[model samples]
Target: MTAGNPTPDTTAEPAPGPESHPEIPWERLSARMVWINLVRLVISVVPGVLATAVLDTPTGPAWPLLVASAVGVSATALACLRFLSTRYRVTGERVERTTGLLVRKYRYVPRDRVRSVDSSARLRHRLAGVRVVHIGSGEARSSFKLDALTAATAEELRRELMPDAAGEPEEEAGRETLGPQPGPHEEVIARFRKPWVLYQMFSVWAVLVVTGPAFGLHWLLQPFGVDLLELVGELVDYERRGFWWSLALCLAVAYPLGFIGLALTFVMSHWDFTLVRTTAKGHPVLLTRRGLLSTRTVHRDETRVRGITFREPLLWRWLGLTRTSVITTGLRQGPDEDSAAGVLPRVRMWEAREVAARVLTGEPSPLEAPLRRHPRGALTRRLVWAACGPAVVTGVLFWLGRTDVLPDRAWLVGVGAWPVTLFAAVFSYLALGHALSGSYLVVRRGAVNRSTVALQHRAVIGWTLRQSIPQRLGRRVTVRIPTPAGERHYVLPDASTRQALAFIKGSTPQLAAQFIGEAESGGRRAAPPP
Candidate 1:
């Protein structure tokens, strides 16, 4: 509250305003935000103080105090300027942020472009009764952020930005903008089960999180003058006991520790995860809320979602688990923000497909059709590339053996690498496949971390087809489907002219039928050149 004005009673019901008001009065950020900023600065300074204590700095103890005073004065001045200049206003159509002293910065976002509103509070912010607000614009990056605002003010701002379409049929003049409303009529689509989270724990991220740190720790210890490899070598004598015994001991110690870290990561990140769909202002919106320390709430406009992907790993496939994620124009594509994409983290295959129908139109199971496999030539190409590594390794080993640097048996390792690489290459080639199920075009690929992306035909706006000289020889063409969410491609390695025509017509039958018919009437000329 400003010193001169009375604080608005936040608990009291807000008076309704005109549905098509030009703008709300510009609201200044709380003056208390200055204190919050100071507190945050102090918290960040603690790490520097601790580092100085550990490392011998040229500056003495008095230098720390001087530095602290300088920082405090700088922060205080900046906070004063920020509190005075920064102001935000919400209108019927847009949210505006006006700040900066000299040049003046004005950021504006139309309400329709706003995709999601995320709120988070650090310990200091929580104590200060404020939270940082993030407004996502469905872009690759977010530009609007409200650094510190009172919890009530933030909620009020969010509500104003999201007008009640249910209350007012239209945003005409002389109509109320907001009204006392009950929660939206929402049904439980799916809830998180412990078994599902357990399955999610064994994901690709878990493998990296568990083992990456172990290797990193070994490297990190080197800077401290501790030789990890030398210590382990001294502890386990290969001469007295077999090398296999020492290797087994290392695995026994490392794996359990990895599992512990994996479990803890899963619990911390996915605590109280829930997916709920409810109608807001008569429009269906999907809400996903989760996280322990940093809780996140994403309100997705259901209309913006383009499609979904059912990701199945090799081990998870055998266990009958499939991870479901949404492809939305409103959310960024990455693991961290991808949770906004995740409809179901890890669910029974049947359960996932069942829920997918509600989330999307057309066939519930998008992988219904028999996928058209790539040509054998594609497999041969993959094998050639896969053999390159083994070939290089074999050459190096032979050179070493000739120089007496390594035993002759070292070259034999390349022979073992060959079969493994061949198997992997074949597996990857076999996995290259695509299907057309109802209104969805599905593409399944990958060897270890298999992903099956099902995109809605209605969501597709354009198609691009490309064929290389080698791919052309094999009658293979890559078709890229572009949507607002992202671009997804299918490799039709062995497809005949008819199959390729059918695939194109499937996406836009009305648009492509004329061209396809003309080609068909042209006889052999329609067929791709040999």
Candidate 2:
């Protein structure tokens, strides 16, 4: 085949790409991984190691510093070795990984077993233009990772492994989408807003920082002979002011600085986020990619998504903000698990519901279904449980006051908390409900930070009924629906014995009929007789 005289059409070879020639070679991780690991060690591990050295200086010329240096060097060497030993490739038949410098372990995953593909890039990896590709399977422990691949290479493997993740759409929830929907090749499902990060200003972390910090930066560095207040005074060239005014000014300055730090964290994790709908092997996938410094992309098989969870904390709920996440199987949740499952950041409640409808493919959000309130016995159960704590505290406080060690009014502290506890119990009772919505089973629970879950019927793998002594006494039972997704189970607590059985029967007709008997008039029925 000379230049201009092309090879015969049939004899022409297909493009030498991943899908075209997966037999390419046994590829090693990026060489830049060495530098990335070194940087990370310096930023994360080295500082703490050096701090430990400062606190305990092991006598002769700081042996601790030498030890820290040795540890950092050893760790960096191990990382480099790891980079050399790790090799992975994608093939038409299966994906394979070979590791272990000495033992040489070989692992293979059949193409069909590939359940999810996630790629992540932290600040160091981003600087090196590499990403860590995490390949997951239905079996939780079967997941493996290939770190330090060039971004292009990681993207290629992801496309090759998740074939449907290319340019196609699956079922087009577009028609049912009440929110942003995919159009043509532009599959933008959800786009993150910068202002959404502001919601974190009201987060528990921010509140704690403002009201009662567990520890302060000054506290941490003060041991190292650094006084933050003195440094601030010297920098500003201000003489010593009144103690209370200086303290108040320090607190005022620290509060905003703490909030700024929180805001930075939010931005680092969720800036420029997007959720898109795409296809993988003829099935639709909810693809979410986000992050500022440490970026991540998660390809969630829509088929494996059991449900959507709209979590509304007390503060967020009052502000009408909801955070959205999915109950998807084989997600391989880690320390940053919330971010892995989250489809939308804290957003308006209506917007969150709209996003839920878009992902779940329903007209009215499954969350909109009218939930049947739990029986009054459930309320009684809550009251009894809520009262136990307050009663015990009040009795202890009364005894303490009676002993003359504590003031008579000291017991009032415990008594005052009772009303708040009772109010919470009532709210918990009111929030308890379950309903069937289309192909989804909707359940709402919790007094604070209420979670409304809309679980898909087919996703439920098993049913469990537990009637504890207390539940039996109250004529109530707890029904647990187990699924491979999310927390592995969803619970409906304190339903009437009869209604629990009835709910199970309605949700899974064939399976329930084989076990649960008809409801009795007293809302109690005998268990299956041996």
Candidate 3:
């Protein structure tokens, strides 16, 4: 590799021999994949055994063994068929895979359009010497997978999909070169240690979402005549406990469960975290690699990047941690791949500034500037909007109480409901704010969890002035800044139109000029560009 380009060294490794090849060019998955699939077959087969037991069906040893044999034979045959059917190849321009024995299927992705390449292996897959390869495109929800491949093949595919570090092929005096020369190899900008990964895992309180699995299990068990609540109460004896004791018991049970889930998710998604910066066609490219069980590697051509987002959640902000995401075109169609695209999954706030300065070269730093706060009317609007739901509920309750449809104590519901509603209203209102500083636009929003996005002005594709009746009455307008990256829309929920316009004009004058001068014209009349 040339200056500033550093290739990963694997020189000591031996190459795969012809004996390992199934064909001249195409490749098949590791034999261990068959064993892995057999295990999966066992897992799927267990439910039937359990169902038989639950139904109190009389079963002989021979009958159960027969069932097992039938399922095993079918699963083993299917696994063999799939292994035989699947094949892949990597060439100069494209990577392709073919699968299915009877109903054949084929998929090919051009090397240039490849946005991300990742590999993952669960416990069985790891033991079987195979990994699942995940390939993503720039379009939303466009992803493909190779069910199983050896580690060597996965690496080879990754190299094939990525542009060469040496730069694209160049013309000699007389003839064309070996291949398009690759851009300079990327340099490591940052890498997270185990401690940092731990911090990031703790930063997200996914434990709070643990109720999803618990409740799902509870509902599923209900059909089997099991009262999940009674079972749990029997174990913990919550009825006999005092308020504080119950609280302590719940916390004791919840915290560890939450930690395990969070830790697993963090490790699976962010193992061996590394970030790299390199140049392609003279523009920067950001690459990320991480994942414990399922490794993911993603690359972004900085030339296609429109801006960046700096996110700080409440708990994370207190720990001085932030995540940095990129905004780019051709990214609007994905199914929330922000986690995959995060350049800084977990970095200190100061580190974010440093990385931003490096990655967003020549652009203004929005973090250094003070954000402009929305007018009081914005807060009032949120409060009113939030209050409507509670007010309607309270009204319904009062009417029901007078008509004897509900108990006289129904009025008491508002005592708790009103306070919670007000809190949400006030919190949500307080969370809304926006700022425009030079070539950057910073938006602050979110009620329970706070998010602050700092974006460059050039990324603002169009300006939308949205006003509801209440917003109009309050002399406020919602400004939406749409970009092609991810699902997030940078919005200033309730700001003065004057401030919004001024901010847009300052950040992207071209877009503002068109919006102001031509946007106001009658639909029938075409307004030329300024």
Candidate 4:
């Protein structure tokens, strides 16, 4: 048998027939999803009722509205219940998921093509003792929740699907030591907190929390025939109490109150935060966490990562924090309908560089390299000059506006145009500095994140040296490497003519020499075209 072929063990049972798969208990399986959906259905009906009330539309009978809401809720609940009753089976060779009430749908994932397995349990799911599992292939992925399965069974299923120990002994199945364990130096690489939760809470009560409800109530009363601003002006008359006294009181109370609300929001969203590294199914597992009310988990295949990037915003730098992300090959497209790409979320910021270096690069240099930009001063200066046109235009416009030479009506145009130019110049400078000071592509074989990539000089699909017209006039060039996936370009936008030619020729001799070598080898000599 071929190495990829599955071998049946003596303990294996007869493969289940198409119609005989075990039934999934609908109530047990999807209780949480159903409850959540029911709550959502009720919430959705409220908006409709509110719209009806706001418009004062010709009213249907109260009973009809109630009955319609009931029917809508019931239909949605039934659909979810039916979906949960689907049965799935995984054998040595393939995975089969079967679902339907009358006409069933079957999905098959062959064992060899299965790339990764992910499992997650939200708060609600944890209460129900269930976890959602996703099985991924390079081109497609599938997900299902196995309700109330024992943890042992979940681990068994993971092992069967992924089969990490292809040649190891069967007796080692239960042992954790079968795989390479992380040393003490290794640490948690990535983490996440639900920022949207904090954002939502802040949006709802920011005004009331920051300024006392008295102020909010006053603002709220404006639509109901109250003129609080005029009343306040009269009450705080300059003739009576001094203006400075009232202003001082407002500052003393309001500013600190605003900060208190912001602090509370941040704390609540990230309360009980925990990020840890552990071995699961003989692979490094990264577990991230946040508040007790909501939890999220992401699983990654360490071998699949192409690179890791650490980003530090100016604010984060001041706070000694760094956000880390990995560049992987494949992921599902989100609901917003972008092209299929990889998942890259902002992990925790504090003490991130050390953790990221240990997990992502196998050495600490990757994170440190980008932070040291002094070595590339010459390269950065040239790039800044090449990309500074936008910034110059922006500065000029700002100067004009400040001097009242540009009309206030055109303020937005000046506002929009200046930032783009300024940002471009800044980014160009940073990229050049990174290439010179921080540049090291440590290509290695069988590293967890950075693995060896095979490239044939003769198989150079395409190459280009490009420069903007202005850049060309300045004698600059940007080298582009085009592969099947897309193009990767590096802009050395301010090299001298001799330097540009030599750099291009040296870096991409394979592509440049391919045509020349082919012509000489084939004896296809010809006069230069006139």
Give each model a TM-score: 0.70, 0.72, 0.70, 0.50
Q: What is the clash count for each candidate, in the order shown?
A: 0, 3, 15, 0
lDDT of 2 by residue, 16-131 (tens): 33333444687788888977877856754654565565556332234434455667777777887788899877776667787888888777676766765666666677789888
lDDT of candidates 1 onward, in order:
0.65, 0.69, 0.65, 0.45
Task: Estimate, for each residue in 34-108, the C-alpha lDDT of model 1 and write its tens digit.
Answer: 777776677656535554555353332334434554666677678778778887777766677778899687776
Candidate 1: residue 14 lDDT (0-100) = 46
lDDT tens digits, residue span 1-530, model 4: 00011236778556554554345322233445566556658764753464345434343223334444566677666757564767667755666676777787666566665655555555545655555665665454344334434344555666777565524222121111111334354355434455523322322234456566656556444433565666766766645667898776655556666656765655554555544565545555444444445443344444444444444444334343333444443433232211122122333443454555555544344544432232243355545664465456666766777889985444456456655655544554543322211223311111111221112222223545556665556555554433322012112334444453443344445444543333334436542331
Q: Which digits, one per residue and each the tens of the lDDT, describe model 3 over residues 1-530? A: 00111247866434233234344488777777877777777776665566555545333222443355466768767877888898877655556677887797767666666766656666777777677787656543445787787877776766566544435322100111111233479677777666665665563455575768887666545545676777877777777886688777876777777877766776777767777775555656576666655555555666666566766666776688877776665443222324544677666888888877677667567666677778888777667766777778778888899999999779678656877878877877777777776677788887766667777666666667788887778777788876655444667788876776677678776556554554345245554454
lDDT of 1 at 73: 64
Which one wins on lDDT?
Answer: 2
| Regions of candidate 4 where Cα sits further than 4 Å from its true position | 1-87, 91-109, 138-156, 164-306, 313-321, 328-350, 360-364, 370-412, 436-439, 442-530
Residue 512's lDDT in candidate 2: 62
lDDT of 1 at 505: 87
